[model samples]
Target: MPRAEFDKPVKVLIVASPYYKDISDNQIAGAVAELDAVGAGHDIVHVPGALEIPTAIGIAERLSNFDGYVALGCVIRGETTHYDTVCNDSSRALQLLGLQGLCIGNGILTVENYAQAAVRADPKDQNKGGGAAAAALHLIALTRKWGNSGQSVGFASDILLAGGKTTA
Candidate 1:
């Protein structure tokens, strides 16, 4: 993982879900505190549940000034299969957004029981929210590096750079 660029000013948006209000709130707080420590500017947004985080992040990506996004939510399994759908779909959605060059911090917790969820929600334990924020910040740094190096434009050691012509 790359170090946090504490010297640079970065803007982050955190979206928390209210489904598992207790756990989600804890995660969001963890994210906020961690980002604050890194000297980054941030905003907190609330949504209905895990399902809504991806869309909120999508909107954030369209902003020209926002540097990154953090999605925090907790989904505890129940007797029904609803948990699987929410967890899987939300994870894939956020991953897709990130792959498209959207800096996303995914903190969605999908666990089989309350105990499992509690472990992650605890500030001292996994604290996945904090981890996610760090990841987003790191990715932002990498994006800046790649953008500056011009490596993101094209391959350097390839014949394609010859304007579709080969030396005779």
Candidate 2:
């Protein structure tokens, strides 16, 4: 993935659901690696399940000084509809938070089985957790480019370049 360059120092919060211990651990590892690469400070918060990640992030956003957030978890499809509810509700809440101006990178895996989650969660393979962290970093860079209001006010859009450089 392309890199997001920060003009200012950043701190990130990682809200993770470790329902699947091994899978969630790998995801967290990938997310941490990405944050470390960008020299961002990060801390992990464990929740009971995927459903709680968004709420944890929301609370952090309100009370903490994090510049960005990475959400990591796994929701594998089982014999019941519980999987769908967990997947949809968690995702929708995260999206709502994003729409409200939070820089969140969602890494929740909604897979059909353990195998799929394993493949995607593996930092050496799909590295989805890393990808999600990158997404949040990009948004952070973009947010800084436009200033804290997060609404582009100029008549013309700024052509963003690497490392948060932009030309109007």
Candidate 3:
């Protein structure tokens, strides 16, 4: 994995869903550990479910100064088709936000069962939460690499009149 180096401490916002408290807790632990390893500061916000994670992050992006964002949640299959909707929609929203140039790491787990979710959420196991944090860090590094290069170009016009030269 590529590690991002920072001269100053980076601040990240973690938007998590506690629908499955145990899984969410584990994910948060892993994410926190990873951020601490890289000397980055992080703040966490809890929403009701996976679907709300993106909206919370979007609000933060518009109102706060976080360097990056980590989204953590879990959606296990149920009797109905709600699982698919939650998983797909949440993931899609995060992707769209990323495309808009917000550095975000999606750690939302979509699994067939609780067992599957457990393994992925476990810090001692797959540790996907940590991976998400790393992803955000890498993106932050990339953004910094292209620092301040998003400026819009201005058009300048020079006009020569009969009496004298005029510039607009």
- Candidate 1, residues 1-168, lDDT tens digits: the string is 544874569999998897777887778777877888788899888999898999988877776468899889888888998989999999999999988998888888888998998889877788888888888888888887777775634444545434686432
Q: Estimate each model's TM-score.
A: 0.85, 0.87, 0.88
1 against 3, candidate with superior TM-score: 3
Clashing pairs in 2: none
What pairs collide in candidate 3? none
lDDT of 3: 0.93
lDDT of 2 by residue, 33-104 (tens): 998898888889999999999999999998989988999999999999999999999999999999999999
lDDT of each candidate versus the true structure: 0.84, 0.92, 0.93
RMSD of each: 3.6, 8.6, 3.4
Q: What C-alpha lDDT, on a 0 to 100 scale, does residue 128 get in candidate 3?
A: 85
By lDDT, who's the top model here? 3
Model 3 CA deviation exceeding 4 Å by range: 148-168
Give Cα distance to truth, residue 157, candidate 1, Å.
13
Model 2 stretches with alpha carbons more than 4 Å out:
148-168
* Clashing residue pairs found in predicted model 1: none
Cα error, residue 51 of model 3, in Å, equals: 0.4
Residue range 22-91, candidate 3, lDDT tens digits: 9999999999999998999999999999999999999999999999999999999999999899999999
